[model samples]
Target: MSQIVAAIDLRVVQLEKQGVTGMALANQMMGHMADLQMIYNTASDRDLRKLCQRFPGFGRYAMLMEEVSEQNQTMAMSGTHPYGDLPDLPEPLKTALVHVLRAAADLERDFQATADDGRGDNQGRLTTARWRWADDLEKLIYQFQSAELPLQTQALVQQIIKATAERIGRMG
Candidate 1:
């Protein structure tokens, strides 16, 4: 997974070389990514449910749900943001993002398992683990989003963001 994150980071480097600085592409990616982090930080199932109301397409955000369902606990919480494009990120960054997603997925699993264990003992550790993973992901996302790529690349990123926002904005 770390390798994947490294690969994605490299891709960002490559994109920078190709010219993708100052564009909203990085920012847009960060926004959706931040939403994922927020969801993982959610403290209650009810909150998760409320969050889901905005993007009914949550089932598509499978990075973390698989493990949760396996534990037989339903999400009572909701989160903002839907799954959008994650294309073009380098392997390391991409892998890191995926790992973040996986961690979220694993968190759901832990949440459910704790419920079943009924010991209430795992809650503290699970919560700590989830937060730890989320924090790291947040740092990486911030690093990528704030990165200053080449000037031409920046313009291209802005163009892509404008086009994408326009497209998705219509649906919203």
Candidate 2:
């Protein structure tokens, strides 16, 4: 699990360096972080302590993941909107964003279902959905880059992409 997580983390870093940013990047990060959390949860106490000592960032990332999980729980309980104050994006971009968001929601639902089942029967479905979401998001980002949007819109898109990449860097 640790090796798998490390490989995924490295891939994400490489992708970010290549200017890939969006739901796909975020989803990949979240997936590996969850796997890391599972490792900690299932490890013996002494092993967990040793892991923390050997890899200081492990503990910090775990805490960060916990905080994020708690915040997500709170937001879900509060029934708050997942996306707030969406910008006035142009036609296909706006449509693409909507599709990506829906795919994200579906991925989350499948992940939770798999977790609840514990047998991981839904693993294939989750993987397929994740890849599809990633592909769609990649297309959207490419479209945003190629389309002739207003200066403000382009700047806003760039800001979003930069922020996401920075956040992922901090996490890794």
Candidate 2 versus the native: TM-score? 0.40
Clashing pairs in 2: none
Clashes of each: 32, 0
- C-alpha RMSD for every candidate: 18.5, 13.4
Q: What's the lDDT for all of these models?
A: 0.45, 0.58
In model 2, the number of clashes is 0
Residues 37-95, model 1: lDDT tens digits: 55556536665455444333332232234443433333222322121222355666556
Question: After TM-score superposition, what is the CA distance of residue 27 in candidate 1 from its true location, in Å?
Answer: 22
Candidate 2 lDDT, 26-141, residue by residue in tens: 54354355456568678887876666565544554455566667777787678773532345677778667656654554454345445555777777867776777768868878
Off by over 4 Å in 2: 1-87, 150-172
RMSD (CA, Å), candidate 2 to true, equals 13.4
